[model samples]
Target: MGEPEAARAEAALTTYEDDKLKFKVQYPSDWTTSTGETPASEEILGGGARDLFTISPPGANARDVNVTIVATPAGADFTKMGSLGDAYGFGYGLVVPLNKPRAKKGQEDRIQFAELIDSVGKGDYYKVEYKFAKPSTGINSIFFVLAGLGYDGRVSHLYTATAQYPRAEEDKWRAQVEAIIDSVVYPPTIYG
Candidate 1:
């Protein structure tokens, strides 16, 4: 007989903690996640980053809405890393370049919105929202990246949520995605 299939993530909502990145975030149980260590030909999946986890809804493809968590190297300042404004700027600077190419033809306008939000126990995190249609498929999609520092103060974990669906269904999934972003909890940082 074949081995039993693994259980799916909870349908209601659940938390995911990355021991290596030292951060935690809540996601829908139905969404599936694949660790960065998953065997792949590329070292960095996107934005020259490492330690990533790709979260996707059932039967979704690359053009559909998905979420990715990435760990990035941090500078010496822990407080700055925790500050939402600073992190927002840092994150914006890092992602714009990577996303430029994905912008829709002629509409490659780089439009974005960002804000600072308070984390329950952690200091703060930056939330950014942006969107563009793929030039090839002409699929309009949106992405949200919640960025904050990890417990070690030496790394920043960015929770990137993305979605692409029919315009009529946007409201339903947009609210769902925002809720998931709000449920994030960062690991405790330890100073030397």
Candidate 2:
């Protein structure tokens, strides 16, 4: 997506801001948000403690699609983190592996598609996507990970948006989730 696409449409959106995190994003109005804690037992990514905001559609369950935006003091070696395989290891080592095998009905999950791109604007950012199967429920799960390397004195921040839904219902949530991902904004003061 380009800068134009980065701008939010005039559709109804709910704003989430944190002066301390020095960033904000607008998600669909229908989605509900839950605040996150720092130094959590379970983390969004490795490095420093992460403050997570999980936005979910109404009536969502464990299998529903949701977006998790996080701010952490973690930093990544951008040079080593710009490929599908690299993203996989980064997630596996620092976060959750996409293809973790689950003994569900004797079926093992696998990655269906994966891509990585390094977008250089004010700084370096790696954008990644992994679509895989969830053997437990026989559904497909999609993960979009955006890592913004350090800018000036600020620590690295990551945005991870994910969806797990039946194939029949993907059309209903994909675009909405993408928009939420693109709407993320970092304060200009942090830039070099």
Can you write out model 1's per-residue Cα lDDT over 31-101, one digit (the tens) per residue? 78887643334645434445676666776563476666666554446444544455446556645565444
lDDT of 2 by residue, 1-192 (tens): 544543545546888876667667778787788877667555565455567778888876634577776765434443222422444455544334333544455444342222222222223344445555555456655655555433324554444434334445667876877677677665432333
Q: How well does model 1 score by local distance difference test?
A: 0.56
Off by over 4 Å in 2: 1-11, 38-48, 75-97, 100-124, 137-139, 150-167, 187-191
Candidate 1 stretches greater than 4 Å from native: 1-11, 37-49, 77-79, 82-123, 153-168, 190-192
- Provide the overall lDDT of each model, using Cα atoms, as 2-decimal numbers: 0.56, 0.55
Which predicted model would earn the best lDDT? 1
Q: How close is candidate 1 to the true structure, as a TM-score?
A: 0.61
